[model samples]
Target chain A: MKSKGALQRAIAENAAGYFFLAPWLLGFLALTLYPMIMSLYYSLTQYDMLTEPVWIGMGNYIKMFTGDATYLKSLQVTFAYVFLAVPLKLGFALVVAGIMNQKLKLIGLYRTVYYIPTLLGGSVAIAMLWKRIFSSDGIVNAILRAVFHVNPPAWIASPKYALYTLVILTVWQFGSSMIIFLAGLKQVPDEYYEAASVDGAGKVRQFFSITVPCLTPVILFNLVMQLISAFQAFTQAFIISGGKGGPLDSTMFYTLYLYTKGFYYFEMGYASAMAWVLLAIIAVFTAVIFKTSDSWVTYGSGD
Target chain B: MSTLAKRRLYAALSHAIIIAFGVVMLYPILWLIISSLKPGTVIFSNPGLIPESVSLEHYVKGWAGVGRIHFSVFFINTFIVCAAVVAANIVSCSMAAYAFARLQFAMKALWFGVMMLSIMLPTHVTTIPRYVMFHSLGWVDSYLPLTIPKLLATDAFFVFLLVQFMRGIPKDLDESATLDGCGRVSIFFRVILPLSGPALVTTALFSFLWTWDDFFNQLLYLNTPAKYTIALGLRMFMDASGNSSWGPMLAMSVLSMTPCFLLFFSLQKYFVQGIATTGLKG
Candidate 1:
């Protein structure tokens, strides 16, 4: 009887907790978990929205590897983009952040100016701006004609240069990563720098030893986040390429292609398979980073 | 040079470099604004910052929009969606965060872990099934698919952010509220909610901006020009005009970026603090 009473009390105590968590729990099941299961099931079949899913046991996955060349090209383009864009962006961000972190006048104003582009980078407007500015007769070409006396190709329209324009767009919006790095830099104690200087260390040496070691955690975090986002890059490529991934498919981002297949072609099953592959790629990359993080990432005492 | 002189020189050099980069960084936006004000005929010919002749013709044309649907409709639609999303995220995320931070639920650890993992899970993995589910429910092309999921706290980023903030609040406040014969709900209303103002503001601001900037879901769900958000409206304008309407497009582009600029300038403090805390802690 006492045990039964205790059980009742426990239930009453925990009831409010469950009540508070109800919305999120329900959402997780409906929007996230259930959808994930259904997506997986769809991946193994052939289906369009108009008809019932016909079982096809790994056909879409097999086709991705063996049958389609555009799929292969998209994979290449996306991987190239991720590798190039992530490093250039992070490097540029770190450099700017180091400058921004300095004790200088009007630093806040400079930070704001630098950050404005990142605020609008994801918009269709900026992508449109990028597309025009890199066109054959646009501002960039006009400037090249006057200054260098040499003709420049229409960067966005050229297959060789199209992907780089996208890369440049990604790198231009390095402000968010820079802001995060600046925050991390501020948390590093001045004492460490002072002590290093007192021990006859130069600025470069102090930076390499004290600052780099301290910032490895933030660097790791930024790397993983940037990597994931870069893989999923869509808006710029989509808008700039006129939603077709044209110029000989040089800028066919993985997400854009997935969007094309799922929405435009209405190949639901194939899109589902592509989505699963994307998930696996992201998971593997993340896991690899986490596994390797022990060598480079150093947690502070509070952490 | 003397030590003081050397320090001053270094500071000046740093300032110069920052200013130079700042100019390069802001050049495209400046060009866009300047190009928008130029007369439609000479916008491409005079690709310089200084306009040969100024006019508001493009702004007028852009605001008139393509067909009979004005830019005002898109603006209203976007604002409605943003407002709904912000309110929903704040309410739903805060409640779940309060539970995780203070309440002693069974399976709390498991739930918290799942929430964190969900933060990393890409939306693409589930986009297809969710799209199908919403389609079957007859929510497509309406604001329901866009707004309803927010009510259930589908955005786990805000949930985790609020959880982190709530955890930092003094547990003694809850203890005292209980002492005053306050129940869990009353305690939440009277103490926790009021004290979590900054984090709540952070959540609201991001929710507002992200919803405004959202394109993928809006593109998928909103097909008709009548129901279009700003992003979709811009896309429609692009498709309708193609390369022939550069001046109007630039004008509309500048207008589309105005809200984010206003929010960033007005709430710089919260923006920086929110980013710092979230990035550093994560």
Candidate 2:
């Protein structure tokens, strides 16, 4: 009798579970699952949103790989961006986190102030402001001329430095990674540091021997997340370059290029193919990071 | 030198470095706030931190907006979309998370995996087909295309977050409530929702900020000027020549950042805690 009652209760609870999961189930089916599968299908066809999809197997992929100079340029630009921005941002974040880990007066206020840029960084207006600041006669060059007697080139206008301005912007908004690092830092026991000091280890030695090892998991976390985000960075380039990866395509982020191909040129199929390749690339990178993380990342529980 | 004196000197050096970085970080925003008050022609000319002669012309003109739609309309549009999303997410996500956390269902493990995978997937891949789906549903120019996803808990980030939060809470309370003959629905509404205050606030905050800052989707769907959100409206100020009402745009940009700044300041503790924990979990 008791077993029957328990079985009935389990059945009822399962029904309730389905009730609560109804919305997500519907969403996963119609929106996420459906769109993801159809995107794969869309990648293989020539559908311009107005015409019935012309089934062309692997043609888009072949064109993209074999003859697409713009694609190659975008790939180069994106790789350069990812390589430069991710490390610089992480390093800056780690440095700041080191400083912030120290107990200081008005630290909360300072943190709030520091995080202000990250919050507003992605907005169109901020990007617009960046464009203005990097203009030839704008505040940046004006300050450079006044302070150092250097006639700075129009940073955003020149192809040589346009993408680097975006890099600077990305590095400046290292607030999130800093917060994560600080959390990891706080978890390091005071006893470990005291023990290191007793053993005559210097601050740098203690940091490497104690703090660095304990924070490796967090370091790995920041690395993977920031890498993925950097790969898909779109708004900065799109807004900065005025939606057309202009002035010799210096700031054409891969996503921006994909956007132009789909929206401006109405080649949705080609864009889908591009998007699919990016997805696969990101997935592979993420998997590699996870696989390698076991060797470096140390957790508190050792799990 | 004494150890105490050495420590004092080191602390001072640290403060100096932090203070310097603080200024560098804040200078752009400060210049923006100052430039918003300066006359248009004097903006680039006056590179000083403060405006020489203050003017409210930018504020006046930016509020007037381009064409017929005022900037206030854009703010209202953003507020409506954000409010609906926040409400929908707090409700739907909590439900989904509660199910994931407290109950066993068919394919529970598989569903969990799918949700996690969705969180990992970059949104760029799904944007096209999702656009096509919405277009076919005649939601091309409407708020439905943007807001409906929130209603369905399509943002697995919040679901995952809330699930982790709920999992942290002990199951003892739910067991007692069940013993009291409280149904799962009652346990959800009467017990769990009340306990998930900080997590819900975090959800509401992120949903509001992300929706407000979202440009691409808003740009894609809402082509008409009247329907533009703050992000889309701000982009409208940028004409083809890379020049627009510079001062007004600055003023409006300052205005655009105000809501986020105010919320962050007032709720600094929750924001910091939420962000710190969210990163560690991921």
Candidate 3:
């Protein structure tokens, strides 16, 4: 009887566990899984939200590759933004982390001060703040005028400089990456540095040989994540361009273009195609990174 | 050179570098605060770090209405949505996490791997089809689309974090609890939930911040301005006027960021641990 009771209890426990996870499982099916499949189907069709989707295999893909000029432009702009922003942001973060890791007085205050921008970085408020600062008559231009006595260009209004404003905004939020780098720096053994000092290694040489090598995995992690995020950036570009992808479409990022196609034009099929193509691009890049990571990434066991 | 003198020089140089970057980092925010205090024309005419005099008129104007749009209603709606999301994430994620961590289940590893894949799939890829699905279900312009997802373990990052923490807990506790004649539910409620406080807090805080800052999803799901969250509401503030009002807009922007700032300070310890572990491991 006891054995039977135990068996029944085990079944009951499994049932309860399933019940607890039901909501998430249901959501995955209805929301995520179904939508993912439907998007694949939509990519082959011509959908305009209002009318039923019309099947047109390979046409949307062809247009994106060949016929669409904005798609190519957005791709190039997004690539430039990703490559420029990710490396520069990570470099700044590493420097800040190194400086803060020193045994300085009021270290906590410095961390807090550095992290403040990250908390506000993605907000509409910051975007508005960016708009004002980069505007023709804003403080930055005012400083330029006072210092050089020359007219400053409208940062956001001018197509040539709009994306750079975004790059600056991204670099300003290096606090998140900086905090991560600080954590990694804490994990480095002090004895290694002590030994390096005995070997008469300068600070720069110690950093290059010991510090950089130890921090490579963390750096790789930061790089991959930042690259993915930069490619998918939408909010900054959207707000700066006034949600129009404007100023000669210079700020038309990949995701913004996808949004415009999907929502603004209601070309759901074409948008779905664009999304899939983007997924393919990101997947290839991510796979390449993962493949190369094995060559350099040192795990805890150094395997 | 004396060692003390060299130390002083280095300290001064470091401080100078930090202070210079600090100004660059903080000047825009300081300017936003001052700009919000200024009147519309003064914001453009006198763009400096500090305002000559502060005025509450912009706050009043932003709070009340920009023409016909009421910012207060949007604020209330955002609060409701965020609160609901926080509550759901805490309850559902903890429960699901307990199972994934302690309970012996078939194909558990496989299921966990699948959950990880969801994290890599850019959410934008799924937005349109999800919109269509919600529209077909008549959930558009409703809170259901936003709130209901949190009840599921759809947030793989939170689930992964919880599972990692759970693994660190000793399994002997589970066996001992079972010897005490406590059933699985009792063990989970009594043994697991109490010990999992920090992990639970971390998950809850992230949910609050992410949902609060979410714009794309909010913009896609919500139709009417009255249903907008703070993120969407702030965007609407920018788009409301044909001509932008920097002063009032910046003021409203500052107000919108307050909750997140307050939450971060109140829960700084958990926030730091959470970001360091999850973000750095990416």
Best candidate per lDDT, number?
1
Stronger candidate by TM-score (1 vs 3): 1
Error of 3 at B33 (Å): 0.9
Report the alpha-carbon TM-score of model 1 versus the true structure: 0.97
Q: Candidate 1: misplaced stretches above 4 Å?
A: A1-9, A300-303, B280-282
For model 1 chain A, the run of ten residues with the poorest summed lDDT: A203-212
Instruction: Chain B TM-score per candidate, please.
Output: 0.97, 0.95, 0.93
User: Candidate 1: how many backbone clashes?
Assistant: 0
What is candidate 2's lDDT per residue for A172-229, written digit by digit as tens? 8888888889988888888888888789897778767887788999999899889988
DockQ of each: 0.64, 0.67, 0.57
Number of clashes recorded per candidate = 0, 0, 1
lDDT of 1 by residue, A1-303 (tens): 999999986786599888889999999999999999999999999889889999999999999999989999999999999999999998888878877887888999999888888888888889989998888888888888999999799898999999999999999989888889999998898888888978989767876797778888999999998888899899899998999887999999999999999999999999999999999999999999999999989987633
Candidate 3, residues B1-282: lDDT per residue as tens digits? 996897688888878888887887887787777777776655653547666777887888788756467888878988899899889888877777787888766566777777778777787778899889888889999998998878876777887788778778888888999999987888888888888889889988888887877777787889987677778777777777744455567778888888988988888888778888878221
Candidate 2 C-alpha lDDT tens digits along B1-282: 997897788788878988898998999989888888887655654578866688899899899986677999999999999999999999889999999999998899999999988887888788899998898989998999889988899989899889989998889999999899999999999889999989988888888888888888897889888988998888777762245577778889999999998888777777777778877221
Cα RMSDs, all models: 1.8, 1.8, 2.3
lDDT of 1 by residue, B1-282 (tens): 997998799899999999997898888889999889987645664558987678999999999987678998999999999999999999899999988988987999999999889888889999999999999999999999999999889998888888889899999999998899998888789999999999999899889888888889999999888999999888887888656678787899999999999999998888787877775211
Candidate 3 all-Cα RMSD:
2.3
**Compared to the true structure, candidate 2 yields what TM-score?**
0.97
